[model samples]
Target chain A: MKEGTSISVSKLTKRFGHFTAVDAISFDVKEGEIFGFLGANGAGKTTAMRMLCGLSMPTSGEATVAGYDLYKQSEKIKKSIGYMSQKFSLYEDLTIKENNRFYGGIYGLSDKQINEKTEFMLHHLHLEDQANTLVKELPLGWKQKLSFSVSMIHDPKIVFLDEPTGGVDPLTRREFWTMIYEAAHRGTTVFVTTHYMDEAEYCDRVSIMVDGKIEALDTPSALTRQFKVQGMADVFVQLARKAKRSDN
Target chain B: MESIQVDHVDKSFQSGKSPVEALKNITFNVKQGELFGLIGPDGAGKTTLFRILTTLMLADKGDAWVDGYHVVKDYEQIRKRVGYMPGRFSLYQDLTVEENLSFFATLFNTTLEENYELVKDIYVQIEPFKKRRAGALSGGMKQKLALSCALIHRPSVLFLDEPTTGVDAVSRQEFWQLLRGLQKQGITILVSTPYMDEASLCDRVALMQNGSIMKIDSPGGIISQFQKPLWAVQGDNMYQLMHDLRHDSRVDTCYPFGQYHHVTFNESTIDIESLKKEFQQKGVHSITIDRTEPTIEDCFMELMNQ
Candidate 1:
């Protein structure tokens, strides 16, 4: 174990009946690094992520997330990491302040701590005036930002975001990435999955998964140079062309 | 001749106490065999305009015509001459792939064999799984099946709304290839997507936002009109770089773009050598700057902010 390793996995495998969804994947994420996970749909990216997040049991592997064993200490793992899925999981009917309080309580924050943190969060996001506004009444970009803030309310060491900027306009997408950069600057590790090739370029390192295996992993510039491609999109197309999965 | 035309069209829907204007004075023309794109984000009126052109909805004012037939007065003729694939997967869930294709063909008074040539390229990919229920198909397969069903009737015009929204990168590339093949067969394609990169694939595009057309031009032409020298700048600290660039009086606009910050000058001329020196004086280190070509996304964002 290294001093600042956030996640470490070796020969991790998962199977559903006879189908091997994730096959002997191995990787490590350093503390505060932005890791981008790229793959075509149905290419086992979700299965691998599920296992790493402690949401599902790996068929076989040696792994540690947030300095806890994946199998024996999943509950402890859950507490040390924050997750925001593609689907908006926050309560829409609740006000921004109420939603923050609810998530803070779920993370086992003391009442005094929750109050202080909630006040700081509202002020930080410039949502103090709209703290009483229902989440549904906000625009899509605001709602997405609020959801991200809620995920970080407990101040977990690591955050997993799945397609965080899907369907947003380019301007809003830029704004969202700025927020992500701030989190990484604050020493919070970020693991994100996205289909947008442009977003891949922003990560410190990226891994392209194909057919339940990691086909290529490197910095965006290195991957492009190694593949003799012009950009991350071309690198993705080149790798995806080699995929054996016909379903996606 | 123009295959489709919209002139001063307007549409709105009542929500709560106020009516939300979905389309506002929209006007455009699609030439025969042209691949035209409607590019915008969600709630930008692309779907509403598509519905009006397909004879599925009526405009509050002005007019639209498809295949030389008025959308309102001759909707039956227009519908018969156009193929529409909606944003959502709209095929029968329980029905198999083969069943869906044949059913749509029947509605147009045609047989699968009669128009199989039109959809053969797309259909063959999913033909092996013809017995699989449409709902059971994966996202990419479902997309292929929906496209095949739309083309089974061999309509002169095809309207696809955000067909590749949730599909993967590879499938999205394949879908575009399929559209190119269809265009070669003399079919005019009107497709909508929120992805700005896809706009370049079309012969012409309309950048829409807030129920209005911001600009209408060929993708290349729009990029040419950017009219400012753009530079991609990066430093050791990206977050700090963005903040400093935004505050600089010489910078007109600065936004984070991938690994670097994209900046345009407020003035017509920029002294790159001086700017580099200026950054060093401000305590920023390892600064790299390069002139870069503007893309359709750049044009869209510029117009949107205006």
Candidate 2:
């Protein structure tokens, strides 16, 4: 393993009975890099992410996340990474401050640290006034931003965001990407999966999964040049159209 | 005559004690056999407008007509002539693909065989999986099935709300192709999506934000109206470059777009060579700058900021 490699996977494979979800996929994510893992709806992108995040065990693979062994150090890997899923995972019924406090406690932050961090985060997000408001009451954009902030409250080495800006408008989506850029600037490796090709273009490097394998992986420009397409969306369409998988 | 017309439409929903205006003086028209797009972010009133046009809801003020029939007065006529595929997958999940298609056909007092020609191209794609349960189908397959079911009744006008939102890239392209084929058959298509690139596929688009239409023009027309000299810049350190560009007095707007930070000057007369020299002087080395064409997304952002 190279010193600056935040994530490394070799010949990773996952099978569900007769179905192979992720088939012998290999890739490496460098420290502080924004790596886009993209695929069609059933292209095994989520399955690979779950294995790397230590939420699910890979059937067979050699991997390390945040320098911890994927199988032997799953718990340690889980602790070192922050995750924000497609669906907002925060408690909808709880107030913003309350949710932060609850998550901070779960991450094993000291009470003093939690208090200080919560205050800072609330101020940072300009949500100090809405700190007492239920998360469900917030607009979609605010909730998404708040969710991202909460994911990073523990100061994890890495953050995994799945479709973070799925339904947001272009303007709000731009604002969200700025937040991501800040996080990456702060030396946190961002591993994200998204349907938006524009978001894929923002990553430092991107890997397109097709039919349970990493079919293409490179910078957006390289991929576009290789595929002979004008943009990432076109590259995606060209690659995905050749998918032998009839499912998606 | 326009296939669909809206004149000063206004709509609001009672949220708790306050009423939220979902549409504000919205007015647009879709030409006969044209593909019209409602482009915006979530909570921008795309869905509300779609609901009203589809005759599922009523506007508080103004008027809308579908197929030359009034939205309120002739809802039955409008409903019978239009096919609506909502954002959500509303098909029977437990039923097989064939079963769902037949059920929708039966709802319109018709059979799949009777209108097979209308949905043949889309139906054929999912025909191999006709026996598969709708819930078991993949996202793309489900999208195809939903589209097929929508057209099973042979409605002259089609209304699709974010039809390709969650589907994969290839499937989205295929879906749009199906729409084009339907258009060739003279079906007026009205679609809504948050994706800006998809706006280019439409004959004309209404850029909506905060329940109001900001601009209604062809995608090319909208881009042409972006009267700023835009440049895409990339350097060794993107975050620092973004921060520096935003703080620069000459730089009007600087946002990270893909691999480059898309920057527009505050003044049109600013030269790109000087801008590169300024960045180099700021201790940023290896900076590349290119004058880029504005996209629909660029125009949308500029309009929203204004």
Candidate 3:
């Protein structure tokens, strides 16, 4: 793995009216590393990802992604990063190749680049035979893989995956991580958020979020060691239990 | 009496130009006090089979019996005698957890007091939020509520379709423990999960794919059929090990499981000494190879390949 630019976030906050979805939180993601963003439902993982991907503005903070400013250079930040949202962001009715074309064009990729990228992605996903198949007809795993590839159409420096393998089978989740590993090995910084404890183990580092702040953040092994747990799954439960107690 | 019995069942759904055969001659029997699992990914016909077995739908071919009664001939009796928890949260969102449980109990012409002992362990967990709307609860809480309602009627058989999907790991473990408790009370459970690790929790499992039974056996039995000597290998250079093993002629199948790659040789006669030598020759310095057992995932992959 290659060393990536140090992402610096100082007291990042995102508020929607009275609800502070992502309350003053900060964490750095190094280059060429898989960082797991973990949280329960509505634990602000999505809100934080939205801010990092430059899709939403932070209420107050100084942050940079891939060395670009998160505020004034938001547009540049978007170009330097890829984001696969929870929802299927691709065109449902479009053909497999057509969705790729649509995403590439939207990312300002030229015709030649789009053509090469589509061909490469299709072959890489072993979906060359199904390029003409409508996206609606594909299985959940194929659609997820294809969607991830499309998000990287512009060759973003960092890729943000929000539950990219969610709703798929465990087998597909394994295959999906292989692709994630491939991306990281190729010097693409992988920033992902998932509730699956096993998926967190696949990452080099993980941050467990509770309430609106990160309760624990470190290498998966370190977290497991500090929490005195045998696995990440148990570690997550311990944190969740703490949160539940506080709420009570 | 057999809890559930499916004999030579087949299901097909018409898609525009052709029909999709979901299940092919599927046959299995769940014992009176066993926790059976239909383990596979989505579109593996788990839901369809469960629906037919629970008397929610009729199979196009073959017949199934619940509690020794034909599914078609005794549909009403089956419904009364079996508890079905669908994959989705089908409970009334507007009703409180207590209300939901009582409603389900009422459906069976029984009161909560009559079946309180059956679901006491699960119901106690949700009793604190008895007045909370079903939809307002957390994922884990909602799951417990669903199971409580399903058991409130004291059904002889329980069918939970992917009940633990989208839930936290701890919740999943807890739910399985609850199932085991019910099994001890002479309740037969048929649970479907896409998770391979949970396969071992079942008394017996049937691995399904594209509507066909790939294999049906105990988890240990299925893993033993791997027919290859497996090894858990880890080294300084995982990338190199993965690449080398994938292309290695002696390696039948290699997959990254957690921190190590579970590799297997095409022929069991190949000794670990020789396999280590081959890896060392491939520049995998300081490799650790130890005999490892195959996982349900490996077994499923092998079955799917064939």
Q: Which ten residues in a row have the lowest lDDT in candidate 1 chain B?
A: B13-22
Model 2 bad stretches (over 4 Å):
A228-230, A246-248
Q: Looking at model 3 chain A, which ten-residue stretch has the lowest summed lDDT?
A: A239-248
DockQ metric for all predictions: 0.63, 0.68, 0.37
Q: In model 1, which residue pairs have backbone atoms overlapping below 3 Å? A: none
* Model 1 Cα lDDT, one tens digit per residue, A1-248: 67899989899999999988898999999999999999988879888888888999999988999899999999998999999987777898898888988999999998998889889878877888988888876777777887888899889999999988877778888888888988998999999999889899999899998888889999988999999987899989888889887563
Local distance difference test, per candidate? 0.89, 0.89, 0.84
DockQ of 3: 0.37
Off by over 4 Å in 1: B16-18, B281-284
Window of ten residues with lowest summed lDDT in model 1 chain A: A136-145
Task: Predict model 2's lDDT versus the native.
Answer: 0.89
Tens digit of lDDT per residue, candidate 1, span B36-153? 9999987789999999999999999999999889999999999889989999999998999989988998899898899888888988889989999999998888988988888888
- Reference-based TM-score, model 2: 0.96
Q: Candidate 2 vs candidate 3: which has greater TM-score?
A: 2
Q: Per-residue alpha-carbon lDDT of model 3 for A177-199, expressed as tens digits? A: 88898989988999988756667
lDDT of 2 by residue, B212-284 (tens): 9999999989998997888989987777788899999988898777778888987878777888888888878
Fnat per candidate, as a fraction, reads 0.66, 0.75, 0.21
